[model samples]
Target: MFKNILLLLCMTALSTPAFAQDHAAQNADIAPDMPAKFTVNTDKFDFIRRDVMIPMRDGAKLHTVILIPKSAHNAPILLTRTPYNATLMTSKAESGTMRSVLQGYDNMPDVIADGGYIRVVQDVRGKYGSEGQYVMNRPLRGALNHTKVDHSTDTWDTIEWLVHNLPQSNEKVGIIGVSYDGYTSLTALINPHPALKVSVPMNPMVDGWMGDDWFHNGAFREEMLSYIYNQDATAKKTAIWWGNQYDNYDLFLNSISAGALGKERGMEQIGFFRQLLAHPAYDSWWQQQAMDHVLADLPLKVPTLLVHSLWDQEDNYGAIALYYALKQKQADQPNLWLAMGPWNHGGEIKEASTLGPIKLPSDTGLYFRKKILEPFLAHYLKDDAVALPQRVSAYRSGSDDWETREALPARDCTTDCTTLHLTAKYQLAMNGSAETSGSVSYLSDPAHPVPYVQRPVITRGAANSAWDNWLSTDQRNAASRPDVATFTSPVLTQPVSLDGQPLVHLTATTSGTDGDFVVKLIDVYPDEVPEQRELGGYQLMVSSDILRGRYRKSFEHPEAIPANQAQLYQFRLPIMNHTFLPGHRIMVQVQSSWFPLYDRNPQTYVSSIFTAPPEAYKPATITIDTAKSWLTVHTADVATP
Candidate 1:
């Protein structure tokens, strides 16, 4: 991995290459290189920290932390629906976690309360601090989003109770949250609660089954998600610092594997375990409460704001797909607005932003985006603050700048939605054909997984942890390694925008009975000096996946890999809303296992998604018909010069 990183540092993403840039100087700022800084006020909004039991429809009491302005006798309602403990308020947290940003500003109380408004934060049913047995990924059974009740029905009931019961005015409420909170906010729109108005699901993951958190193409994100619930589900009513490794730094930092904590704490909630073992295929269980299923009843709910990060690494793809769908449904209803930023699923620290351990200006600086969010609420519940213009704005990668459009990305979605056919190793480069032959392959060990930072789930408590599986080195870099396979294209003379789902189509026979087929779409720019810190320049990972070789043909059933058989292997990875700009090359990286990040697929197709030991794993030969096998991507024609 360091060797891969070393090569990356030398090549650089933006410039004077081969002669080499100073690696020591270049590597330091790789994380906070893109300098966008702001300020913050770390003082906590001393709202009446009252622990009230918000009665669910099932008559079960769920805990809520109401952080109303101490000064406000009458204020508007700013609600956050969370699955993590509602009591998990930060003593040092000022801006809000990435999850808080998704759910809506945690600073609503301070932002508007100074302006005079109340922030009502509620924990969802069956999770931390809330009463009832927790069901991981519970479908919205009834109107509420719960097993017996559901979020839609439960939320409506809560709003009804809070408005009448809690001390507030205007009877107006706005829902917000990220990940689970985003789901909860979406539920607020579905079947429309009359009192609920205005909402923002930041980097929200709408579909539990298909593209978000739990699984993608039947591949479960075993470590990040499970590790988190274990620590959190078993924790006491105290706020721990998120965004780093495990709960105990000494243990994780000392090179302890993730399993040690679960065993030490004896924290077997089994919520996640049941989720992993239960569904091997995309079943009705996952489909039941997906946003797509309930979109017909989606309410406009006062003005809704959709904030997603292009590099969100977690929920953006799923959320963006759902956002476009919702925009189409509510085309006539001028209530939806989309904002995409450069931050990860939660918030990636800015280069110059002030932040420290104890939390002061740094803590406050974290919430600046939350401050930007203040105006949205001020207008709706309080009927004040100037309104924002243009419903859509997205930050573009490579260019490292923000772009805004009046309408959705019609130019890309409509015009650039051309399908590229996948045959073997070489992909038709827009108007051209492949230069290289053979398939792109790599070794994906399930144990020593890579790292997924700068995206969401940089910490455990983040709402989306799906992409954590790709936490390792680049597949192209990995392909450069003997254990992997590489398929490269000559750097494009014309810029291409890979704006949608990138597909890998192949007809190959695998050796050693059965194995998985993994595909990664990568953007390789002209090597330059590592600007901020990513050495060897940065080759941003567009999307990736590992299709269980056994389930290569079907997700529902499993089959064996006949030795050296010419069976078809097709992998449709997560979507990529990216622009592979000019002077950059597009490469495909293929590898088998993503290590401990994702559970290992015992080269032989198996009934279980996990528990495949290392002995069961063996190097299998996957034939990529270079001349016949090809990869396809939804790319934009280079804008005619």
Candidate 2:
């Protein structure tokens, strides 16, 4: 029951903000008065919600809720597998909790009203109402030959039972969901059933360590600790606030270290939390847990629509990684496609037109639902002949235009892809003077780490929380911090466009053996914006990444940084398509820590950071050697519109 609440947390916050702008002319086809909520009144619709336990191949029964239209003969079945309990959709037992859970619950309510399909929502095995032992990202067992049971097998079994058992069902099944639910949809693609025609996995949690939900570049996400505690079967839901503390930045810091905080809250008893501490490095433990490794060899048989978001706070890289992997492996499977827009985690279901104070060109949420998602699924499920768009569909953040391609564009040449050297004077420039070889040093105190954003950092799982849009906030607060090294370039004379991943090559020396490097690529708006007056001098973070110093060589083999020695640390930031308009400046902010968001690295490298005592946390000085360090960016010349 608790799992259902956590699963729908972000989905609820995704729709809190209304589309405040008037884009009727821009989105002419989309209804101007489209309800702010992403749900339909169940009472107004003629459907019967039946709860039943579906038996799996392994004899494990799964709890499922079948919502069938009264006029359902010859209609197809639209199914969604979820860890979240399914009865919340139809039960009027607790109106208060039901209202809270379904605040922004998103589903094909329009399709339900149209009454052409029977909607099936079920709980995944071992979660909530389902019976079995729960395992996160249950590793795929290579192949299915009546050997072992995984999510894929469970999906196949469920679909097989539904097609044969349900009356008036045409035996056609389609799967769809978001976040954890999306993961289940993805699992259905591997060794799928014949009846599983289509699936859509939006911002799915594909991997634990590789920039999706849990860890980033092998660095543990401290902000998600509360979530880990919340999901523990034995533990109750965690309080949103940490004992009257307004700013999570301060609350997390006061706890000393992440492990210390977990211990204080008795989180170390949780199996998943304990496992995280056991395998700090990307060893076999994390390797098996990765979706890439699990589904690496399995060919995608079912046509899938991979959905991701531009500002997704959680699981940003998974769908993109999946899209790329599918492109190479399923080259002949032309049905594989990607659609990305300007939204946070699960924000695509909401008003995608605006993120925080920024406004997109149109209501991308409506456009995506009407033009892409609805049609793509309808074509396969209902045999509708409406054609889909190009394979790759992405929204350019600043440009405010959708760019579609048969395949992702390649990196530009040397002329267009420029390399800028970081200067000792805190300047980012194209030309470097060998004679002016210098380094800038700063004091990095674990006690007073750099805050990720100016606002008080809130836990992301809370409803209508500010955590979703923190990525879009200005970096003025962090740039002015003494621990952060700021490098600014001259105002751009011409518009510069970036179309690929931004690479950061750093040569730095740390006083201690273990630390972190957070590199941020920012777009500095002009000081005077006559039209949008408040947006003047806005420091919009375009791309950013973090790497643990110990993981410099390999994630599998973490070698501590040689103290006081300049070591080269190379890593790529998340890929993004954005433009630096004329009169704007490009800035880079490098820091040793991003507090609360990431665990504070105890400068001294120890055998186990989790067991390291509070004394291990100490102050250290980090130097950025400009002579040997540079930031390279992949850019494209202005193309004709």
Candidate 3:
């Protein structure tokens, strides 16, 4: 078992390496020199790096890497804890602790190169070199028990140990991380050590059900299944690489079954996968896993900087939801601030200014790091008073400029509610006449689920580059599908800007007992678009969401819908800061399934969707009542682009 775990860890390195496939030459048998280039300038710097096992409160030792610059006079400490290996190399190259130690500082961001600080990175319990069992987004403990310790205690112990043991320490410490690492950074804030003065939890995993990793508004995230298991030894004996299949949609539909995933694929061996299978609904188990309750109750001991991307695939709702939760506690003068951009996942920290073909207004990642992140850390940790961003600093997609606000959603921004009715003629009209009342219907067959993206996709996990840019990819591929119902507004004569979330209300009836409704708000480019651009007639999905019919009334208690009965289902899509320019058209697409992106809804009600049999899958005709079904959008009159 030990040998198998180590083999898995060494094989499936940090999710998917952005370098692996790109450098794989057409005829070359050997892979490229990736490990050497992962972290550059290591030889030029006098930073002394060491690997150590730090004992936690429970006597379990966590594998940690400490790097202190030899030229440092007195420096502050910055710590990041990650489930991904603390060192750089991909899993294929990770041989042993000795190999990683010899590699020196690899895969760290360039900002650290201008270091006047002590940097530390560590693997959480049960991951990589750390000892003890691993738990996904472990729940916060109420009080410390002698028998057990949570992530909070582990963090406090690590910080306490670092402050005392490390020389040339100024005692002040800061924390920051992205994705899973971001979760650890956020966890460190719960009863934080006195020396921990500042933090930036960028794109943290806040909740599983609400719009992060696993589930989105009760809809199962199918792509994450292969992601979670392959990345960790807790789930699989070794990483399962589904080689570059020409058509991923067909690959998933024909190969994987949500009901039989555990029985057929041996997913039962994975602890968290077992727990996910057991709890289909948002029950006590999921509630206990939620971080919102814990975040709202936290004392504002350290000033926090919440960084997020407007298009973050993994944790889009995390930073926003956390901002709202933190605001509830600090209504008077909040210490929490937000910096949002059009980056993917942790792209705000990377050098990428463009996602796919959509170019950002400016170098958002660099601006945030220099103007917001660095200033915030320096001010709190090093007593450096620099002009840092205040309250909210968000990038406006259409305008291509950063907008600062006193609060998120902008305090002074007035919303003009516009309703686009789902018309009988397969059109989205701003105003509907009495005679235009009719229904539009489509057959939603479970055997042929709708594909979320164009097929032949080479990537697998959400951590990969492809998954990061899928949110803004052109939706024209799925638009022509018979299963997808697209309603479009005539080309616009004036510009329309949206600053907040959109609400999708539908009065619909299905042929089966259960179904999923996917709503997408799109901006259609003009026909005479530039050749090099994202293009004319490009359908960019600005905001989208899915609602499981059974959970319409309550997420905790799901009830099957009455077949052929008109039921009103409504849910808010993720927020956006996009503007539909003149000569563009607004489109609303309604569909039953998003394919492998989300697990196919059985359409027939069962005890649990995860355990439903193959026979339960059926075809269903969904009809949208024209008069009652309309998408409500929040638009602002501001025309400054």
Candidate 4:
């Protein structure tokens, strides 16, 4: 269950601060009550007088760690409901054990205690101390034996109990959390108690679709996230799933082929890990779990501040898609303001001062507490003079600069869509508006396929790992191999903005009835300078994805190709917020294998995505449809609002 994700590991120490007094500074200010110094009641603060048991309507009980502020005055309450074991939330269940030194506890207790608020942490149902059978996705249904409860239902019930029992200010409650807890924050809003007025879902789950933690267009994430239900506490009933859940992943690695499991590579996996082999197509199994379809089921009456990471190695992309989708829905009632940074899953980016070679003034976390949580809580709950405003800032890895936009990126366009003909001789060019054509070829061997860059080195589960950079490396580097094909673009004299996802159209013939088409979007940088850091000091990998040649026509059910017969394939990759500068270059690398990243295509039409034994994979060439194949990207002009 230990995944090495990039969740806000960013570390921005109090170094030289940015002096550019921008608008973020104007409206996004700290509370006047911020103390120059503070005190932590180490004993009372650290001690959980008792392990409180919370009950849900479904006859289920939840285990919680309640930390009361030293103040006897009934003030507002701040709660964080997490799945990462209640013990890790705040203070220390026991020191020098799982955590080093209460992880900046002084900062946490200082913030909440200073406000005279009670902080509580609960192990989500089916995880850690909480009781309930542990299902990774935690199917909307409770467990096989326990009371059934869903996220929305659980929070609604949880708040109902807190308002009456806690001595806090009458029913006035504030909820804040990140990742799974972030999702809980938003989930609370949909079916919230009257006391739930202000909430923040930081880098929350939008739903599993194009941006879900895993399975981007049927592509499985290589790393597996283990459902290590170390402990489960429910209604005084408890169950712990024994040992390390992830270590046995190998036993099920091939389970996809046996029609015995579901992909659990990322958040999307959380919803349907059990059906990985069953639902190769976006059938009812996946569609039902898709949160986008269920937002209508939400009662989003509370004011909300949504936060996501721009370079989050995990759920940000999906959350971004959700933000735009909700904005377009015209249901702005929640005033659902959004904030995006360059952080990761668990604030990893915030703790990391550098991204590869780029040394940030501070990990994106510097402004996290000050610019986001603090101002948000002040404006909504405390009615402070300074309120937080809607923010849309993207950190460009190349320039080490942050660009602010008035609004989110709704849509954009490309200046041109050019087709390059890949002759046998390796020539490249943009065909005229009329029609241009050429071709390239490479072999895809199931036996020796391309591996997911991060799989072997790191555990292949969890969508937000620091290892995500593995997905974006230059494809050209892959082209040097005999099995992969590479295509280059003429150096541009002007900047090219690829602000949205791109579509690749290819015409090809497979040696067998099935195969796959892999396309990578690469940013070829400029000539390197010695001291200034290399052109690719960032190795800024943009995006890459694979498409089952058979599913090129429909995602529902795929149709295999006629052996030795040529065919056309089309696939779309995730969107981007980028501007390829004048001096830079663009390169597209195409491959057949993305490794454990996606199940290997058997090169034979089968019912599942991974329908093969290691030996069943045959070497086949992906003949490029030169005259017919083309890559198109959506570009935008820099005309600021």
The list of candidate 3 runs beyond 4 A from truth reads: 1-44, 89-108, 142-147, 234-238, 241-246, 410-415, 431-436, 459-465, 531-534, 637-639
- Identify the runs in model 2 with alpha carbons over 4 angstroms from their true place: 1-44, 89-115, 142-147, 234-244, 330-333, 410-416, 430-437, 637-641
lDDT of each: 0.56, 0.77, 0.77, 0.58
Decide which is better by TM-score, 1 or 4. Answer: 4
lDDT, candidate 1, at 623: 63
Clashes of each: 54, 0, 2, 48
lDDT tens digits, residue span 1-641, model 1: 99999889766754554325566567766787554866443254344445688887778888887655556665677777776556654233445332232233333324544555566777776666777655544566654343567677778888898889765467888887766677778777766678877887777777755667665566655445444555355434343333234422232323232333333434344455445456657666566656756664555655777766544555645566676677677665578777665455544222213111111223322333443466666667776666664566554444433455665543233344544333244454443343434454334343333322322223444445334323223444454455545555666776566554556666666666776566677776567534433434355566676676766666666667787778777766654556666666777655665544444555655456444434555556566665445556555333332
Write the number of the candidate with greater TM-score, choosing between 1 and 3. 3
Which ranking of candidates, highest TM-score first? 3, 2, 4, 1
| Candidates in descending lDDT order | 2, 3, 4, 1
| lDDT of candidate model 1 versus the reference | 0.56
> What's the TM-score of each model vs. the native?
0.72, 0.86, 0.87, 0.76
Write down the RMSD of all candidates, one decimal each.
17.6, 14.2, 11.3, 16.4
At residue 270, give the lDDT of candidate 1.
Answer: 47
Cα lDDT of model 4 by residue, 1-641, tens digit: 12333333322222225434464596578566768888544563333333687997767788886655444345566777777767645544444221222343222433454455566677777666777544433435422224446776777777788778876444567887766677777667655677787887777765543455655666554343332222122222243222233332343344434233322232233333445545667666666655545554565577777776655555645556666666667644456666655454545314556544345666666555566566767665663486665455455444445555555544333454434344444434445333345567777877666654532334434444325444443344455678877666566676666555566777788778888778776666666735545544223456556776766777766687798777777766655556666666666667787665556677877666544555555678777766676666654445322
Candidate 3 per-residue C-alpha lDDT over 112-154 given as tens digits, one digit per residue, 9 for 90 to 100: 5364777788888888778977777767774322346778888
Error of 2 at 79 (Å): 2.2
